[model samples]
Target: MDDAANPLRIPPQMSVYADKHNLFHLLQRMLTGLLIDQPEDPISYLVRLLQAADVPKIMLLGPPAVGKHSAAKKLSAELGAVHVTTDSLLEDQSELSAEARQYALTHQEIPAELLIQLIKRRLNSVDCVDKGWVMEGVPQTFLQALRLQQAGVIPQHVVMLEAPDDVLLERARGRLVDPLTADVYHQTFLWPADDAVAQRLEKRRDLPEEQRLADLQRYRREVTALTSAYQHVLRVVNSDQPITDVYQQVAAFVKTRRYYRTPRILLLGPPGSGKSHQARQLSEKYKMVDVSCGRLLRAAAADGSAVGDEVQPYLDGGTPVPDPLVLKVLDKRLSRLDCCSRGWILHGFPRDLEQVRSLQESQHRPNRVYFLEVTDDVCLERITLRATDPVTGERFHVVTRPAPNSEVHKRLRTRPEDGVDTVTQELRLYRKHTAALQSVYPDAVHIDADQDFHSVFEALESRLTAD
Candidate 1:
């Protein structure tokens, strides 16, 4: 048996019958010394203690919106570590050079060469030396991590933090990023104030469904692969626990390793309410997963197996898939990111009253639900903006069209079912179902989608900032 591959290697010396109570306290003592009568600055103490433990160059990875940045800031402040994130870099840029802007638009990752250069640049800075530096949102792949390692930048420890998918999606959905400052606000959890804050923050609306899902899928793949390659240096932690508890546990983990931060959100909304849109943007901005049930189910169905056969009917019929199947699919997809332990953005699934009930029954529920409440007329208008698929001839309201000669419009021109009446009827059904769905989850926040897309996003930003 390969001992390295064993689960025991992941977190050693834990018996099945170990005491559950005071578990965290036990971990804290063993990892970072007893917090009992500890110094006022626990973070600073932990950093010095960890250095004594011979751990340095920590990397933290997790889904976005799970408080990764906050945790990093708090930890850095405590340890006098230099904190670096993409948002900080973007802020310092005068204007994204043509190449940089192109990279942003295309969602091309920060290349390892560029990242390496940036690291060298940062490291040479007076502030970055002596004081340990904590890097966020770089080396998104195993190859990149390897490149850093070969460059003698190997982190002493790596940490991955994750929450349930729904929590991540909700967090993503409720999030508002101030475009000017790159400040984040969660609708019910972390609302911000100040007109300047409000004006600078912008809710993203340009992302399309396919792009959102693709980005999420890509993050799950790349991050997981990267982490696996550094199995020996990694330490995984679940952020699903309460913030205080998660904070304590993670502090302990980093006390022994290098790591990244991941935030999870559970997104909830009406049909075509742009929940998926929000999820993708958050994932890109935060470099996390958008755990979309629709995409997950479709992927499973595309496999053409027994389970896929069962899933095909629901998707093909334009009906909601069952919760059990949704869970099964989610379980499998999430397993792929077991190494990431980063937070994720959960979009789709948990629709209507039954789905909500199902989620509760499974004991996995979103931290929040960001409802995009549009009038029937507004929803109709938004849905009509969509066109048919070029290849399959399937009409969809969410997929992006190329332009006036958009692939979507071109496809609509040829599809037999692309008539105005068909679209109108589909919109009608969408409205009818969503109205009922609203009644089921009465607590869901209502964001007005009747305004211009940016205005709607402004309202969303306002709601989130208010929190």
Candidate 2:
């Protein structure tokens, strides 16, 4: 092995294990604690962090009568997250700042600054932090949203329930509340199944229609700004559906796995699916490392180190290199700073579940995985019929792209690995592993590689910009 190949060679499998068990997130939180407190007893501080409860921070936002209350209540009960609302924060008038108190006493809207102060205090409460919190219908204005963000009241998930104004109006008209339980119900839509609870439902006092319309219009005016402020974490859901259906959608969105934030991209598909071309384009534009496994292995082999010596025989014989050697090379390349900081586009490796499992342990596991799909026949034609110009080292395909002139094409040579027999074998292996590989990356973007290279690259580029 070259001493310079890798200095701090962490085993890749350990990274896989850590990711599987969420140890990466745990360490992240631990580091955050160390940074925040700068505690003298660092180990003890870490131990305390391990024992701290991870409470869910959630926000439910919507227009009046848009089912935010019902959704928030269910989510709070299920996740054991404390339910906080503007009303809950204001229940104790004495806790309010004098400025806010004056507005409340006068039945007038409080200014954003004073309103956020009260919210900030409650959100930072011991209960809210320890048990997690789900806030309902606070910061209904853009300024209030900004004030909460300035106060660091960030939620992991922010859901906005939406419905037509007419639907909300009708629901408001039919709204009922249980005085004993304070659980809201709609007479037409959500009559209690329990006969006793149904009998006690009181028609809640309706805000005068004029006032209600005014409030709705106010919401319409501020909604675009409010949504834009939290766009990254926000999910807008239709609330006109059945309660069960609405809750399921909201719950699913809340529980979905958030992808790693870093821009590591993985490209998968059968060989000759334009992964290499797309990767090069992305690297050129984004300044990310193009970690092509085949290229790296060839480069390593030509370097004449112990690592190169071991893999050169496999390359010369056209036999598959063992997984361990492949990982050894990848672990070294992936650890480089360009890949870590500027980000990476990895293709032509991790061809099966075993490789994906090993990769899971490493922090370099891709957050964005794309699979470019093409037919087996196309793969065969693309790979087998392509010849490299030995003099210029440029590849030309007989069917798609040809050498400029016969004089220039005369020296073109096809490597043994590009032979029809070899390509057929490789395609067979890929076909066997394709399903399991896709199963591991269900969220991976699938692209149509059969199209022209420009279209394929555009599809990949559009998806990258979307993030």
Name the candidate that leads on lDDT: 2
Worst 10 residues of 1 by lDDT: 10-19
lDDT tens readout by residue for model 1, 1-467? 12323342222112111222324323434343323224577777566444443323556776655667766766667767787775455444443333344566677776676666556456435566456666765666777877765554655556677666567666666677877655566666666668678666666554554654565566677766776555545656776665667768767866753322223356654445677777776566445578888787888899765667888999888887877888766655543433124346677765555666665554234434566766655554455556656667565554344434455455563333444566567556555567665665566667775555567655543333121
Give Cα-based local distance difference scores for all models.
0.58, 0.81
lDDT of 2 by residue, 161-215 (tens): 9999999999999999998988999978888899999999899888899988999
What are the per-model C-alpha RMSD values against the true structure? 18.1, 8.6
Q: After superposition, how far is residue 93 of candidate 1 from its true place, in Å?
A: 33
- The TM-score values for the models, in the order shown, are 0.41, 0.56
Q: In model 1, which runs have C-alpha deviations exceeding 4 angstroms?
A: 1-262, 304-306, 313-320, 338-340, 389-411, 414-445, 452-467
Model 1 clash count equals 44
